[model samples]
Target: MNQQYEEKLLNLIDRMVETASDDELFAGGYLRGHISLSAANCEMCGKTSVDAMNNAVENSLKETQSELNPADQLIVNAMWEKLRQEAYNK
Candidate 1:
């Protein structure tokens, strides 16, 4: 992610942190790690577009899906989708 996307993501997370439930907070935090890692990876690979950032996030989430239980996965995926929409659909 570039500066703009990073700012958007941080703003989203800030709002989430302020209003989320305990479970949601956990989910958001977990997703944040994936998003950050994906952004860093994208930067390293010279892919600065928002599309690349989105793809990196999706790939990271998909690759880790099996690590979460069904309920947890559902929460995480929901949060991820929300972030995706806010970050990319704006």
Candidate 2:
């Protein structure tokens, strides 16, 4: 991710942590790792757009779906979408 989007994502996650429910908090932390790692992977592959970053994150999560229960996966996906909108949609 670009520095601006990276900072935005960090700020968004910080705010979410402050007000999120228990489930959201858990999903936030879990998704943070995926998001950051995905961004890094995208950068390494020369994919810098927000869409590329989002796709990497989603694909990573899908690859590890067995790690979370169905409901938790839903929560994580929802949070990811919300964060993506907040970060990229301005």
Candidate 3:
């Protein structure tokens, strides 16, 4: 990944960790790792990591959506939106 993309992904993970609810612990952590690894892998492949990470995270969220309680799912969705927006906010 480019430095800028790596920074943005890390920054997004930080923001998520800061604001995520207690119930989001495992999911958020997994999301962070997913994005980080994807970014690092992209650097080796000479690709844009942001888009790849975004799609992976989005797909992961969709699969995990059923795991959250209804109310928690809403919160997760909102947090995901915020993180997504912040990731590209530079």
Candidate 4:
């Protein structure tokens, strides 16, 4: 993963710290771990595309889906999609 992509993703998460609701805050914190891990994995595997980074994050979340209840899974998934879109738009 490129440093720019990782930075953009982290920036989005950081920007949400002040105004996000409790659920959004939780989702952001949870996603931060997955996003960081995915970026590290992508870098290790020589994957540099945004799509690859997104896929890696999505796969990581899916792999751990059982850890969260359905509502939390929905919140996290929605947050991921929103962040992904915003990052691309920026």
Q: Which number leads on TM-score?
A: 4
Could you give the candidate ranking by TM-score, starting with the highest?
Answer: 4, 2, 1, 3
Q: Which regions of candidate 3 are displaced past 4 Å?
A: 2-7, 15-30, 37-49
Per-residue C-alpha lDDT of model 4 across residues 1-90, encoded as one tens digit per residue: 356887898899999899999999999999999999999999999999999999999999999999999999999999999999999888
Q: What is the C-alpha RMSD of each candidate to the true structure, in Å?
A: 1.5, 1.3, 3.6, 0.8
Q: Clashes in candidate 1: how many?
A: 0
Q: What is the Å distance of residue 68 in model 4 from its true position?
A: 0.2
Show where candidate 1 strays beyond 4 Å: none
Q: Which residue pairs clash in candidate 4?
A: none
lDDT of 1: 0.83
Ranking by lDDT, best first?
A: 4, 1, 2, 3
Per-residue error (Å), model 1, residue 82: 0.8
Tens-digit lDDT string for candidate 3 (14-86): 6657666685665555556656665666666777656776675677677777776888777666666666787
lDDT of 3: 0.65
**Model 2 residue 14 lDDT?**
86
Assess the local accuracy of residue 77 in candidate 3 as a C-alpha lDDT between 0 and 100.
Answer: 69
After superposition, the stretches of candidate 2 with alpha carbons farther than 4 Å from their true spots are none
